[model samples]
Target: MTDYDIIIVGAGPAGLCAAIETGKEAKVLVLDRKQEIGCPKRCAEGLSLRWFKKMNLKPKKEWAVQEIKGAELYTPNGKSIKMKAKKAEGYVLERKIFEKELAIEAVKKGAKILMKNQVIGAEKKDNEIELIVEENKEKKKITCKIVIACDGVDSLTAKMLGLNTKLDLKETDSGYQYEMTGITGYDENLLHLFFGTDIAPRGYIWIFPKRKGTANVGIGIGAYEKETAKYYLDKWIKTQDGLKNGSIIEVNAGVIPVGGFLEKMQADNLLVAGDAGHMVDPIHGGGIGIAMEGGRLAGKHAIKAIKENKFSEKDLSEYTKEWYKLSGNDLKRRLKGRHLLEKLTNDDFNYLVDSINVEEALRIGNGTLTKKDKTILFTKKLITRPKLLKLMIEYARD
Candidate 1:
């Protein structure tokens, strides 16, 4: 049996970030089921530079493949709106490389990492958490003062702890992506987003360039769609001149939890971060930044609890409180916005694209519109579409 101050169940960005923070003053150990870190890649790999700046970290050249200057949004009627801003510029990363670098940083901070290990069960004993893990085809027991479940959307740790991480079908998006080579006619410094019922049903399609000649072409569909993501992605790819002849070098698929952050992310001696806690952006499906933030916050509070020698649910509630203070309102607004969007029809989207300019579209996407801006936009929209306005009001109240 092995023991540590903290044991993280997943080796993704969130788990690694927690280890890096907690390892500063606590004995931290991270475990993953994969033999190698960042394997079986399953993300679009786009990250905003704003997050890196906010985190006081520099963009790593080795992990970055392309710098994005802006994004183009295409409506159902083929009208496009381009959005560009200093804060919106980002990078398309090689996620495998990025995740590995995070793990290396955590180790450098004195965190021990054990790959090819899966935590099968967890139990609370006194002030410590006992974890049953499978390593090398054998079951092993490890004890820890605290456990952070940074596991992905289907987190077994959260389930073991009896946390309500259940996601309704409507709250999740089925996503699929193809890393293609020999692709042409794409702006290497820009992202393209296509929205239409025919293209992606209730969700959207995205083209995130990785390099001059390669890109991560993907589509996400709401669970309400009967067709699979691959079907829609393939259908859209056929209509694209640049991607029709491109060769797929890699394929990745995953579920994105966009329901909103879980109301509760902690239990005695345990904290849940990342997708397990549903920290993903409801509108854009961006999670890497939020997941890391959650992990860092979890680590900070966990350390505080350890120093006080208190590992109760009440003691760990500080993590949830702090996280809400930082991002709670923003997340609530996003959920409201997503709900409003879900009520729109194809024609409604077309009307919106025709009515709003690039800057307005960007503001909506970034959720940076001022109250006055929204009032003006909504007043004009309501005059033209009273039914939609009623639905928006309903969503807002909800």
Candidate 2:
């Protein structure tokens, strides 16, 4: 058996980031099931400039492929609202390159990354956690003082370690995406979103351009929706002139944990981060930045745990406390907004399209409303629509 101070599962943003931090002081190892890192991209790849600044990331032309100036939101009736502002500026990333670069940085920090390694089982030994990993069909046991499970939605590692990371169907979103090429008629510098019950069923379709003629076209819908995410995505594509003839070079399906955040994200000698802990935005199903933040925090706390030689659940709970303070409270509020949006009908959506301006739309979409913003939303924008007003009042309450 081999020994490491910390073992991070999943080489995506979350695992690699945790390794980057923990590697600075402790011996760290990152393992992923994928044969090639970032080959099967599972995200829309739209990360905001705000997150870029928060994460202290410098945009690289090699991976930050497209600069997004704004977003275009469309109603079921096809009315569009263009939201362009300095705060909204961001980028579409070439995630394959970006993730590989993250791995390199983690390695530079002295973390070891082993690809084609799948952790099939985990058990708590006397003071360390032993992980049974399969490498090239050979099974081996590795002992680590702590385990950070970043295995994403449907995290098996969390369960294997006796943590309940199960997600309710209502709290999970079915995501389907296609890397498309040779598409036209949309602005390459802006992200596009289309919303309707018939279109997405409690979610939206997104187009994040990676280049002049290529984009990531995807849809996120309730996991229990009668129609599948791909079904709705394909239906919408057939109606669009720009996307109907586009070629799909790659396709992937995944689940997003929109809510159902774990109140306790740690167990004895184990920690869960990223999608494994439901550290995703409830409204948009965006997890990359949130996952990275979770990983970084977990890494920091894990270091402390190692220093004190305290790997108990009580000792590791500080990470969960800080995560709630940093993101959980706000995400819980956003969950209310998501619930409200779920109740909107096609007519209500179209009504909302005409009621709000670009700024309010952005606020509502991002779930960043203030007391003043809520007051204005209810008093002015939703005044006439009593149904929507009631809905907004119900959800807008803090």
The clash count for each model shown is 0, 0
Error of 2 at 80 (Å): 0.2
Per-residue lDDT tens digits of candidate 2, residues 144-229? Answer: 99999998885799899989999978799999999999999999888998999888988999999999989999999998889888
Candidate 2 accuracy as TM-score: 0.96
TM-score of each: 0.95, 0.96
Runs in model 2 with CA error above 4 Å? 86-88, 365-381
What does each candidate score in C-alpha RMSD? Answer: 1.9, 1.7
Question: Candidate 1's error at 367, in angstroms?
Answer: 5.1
Please report, as a residue range, the 10-residue window in candidate 1 with the lowest summed lDDT.
389-398
Question: Candidate 1 lDDT (Cα, whole model)?
Answer: 0.85
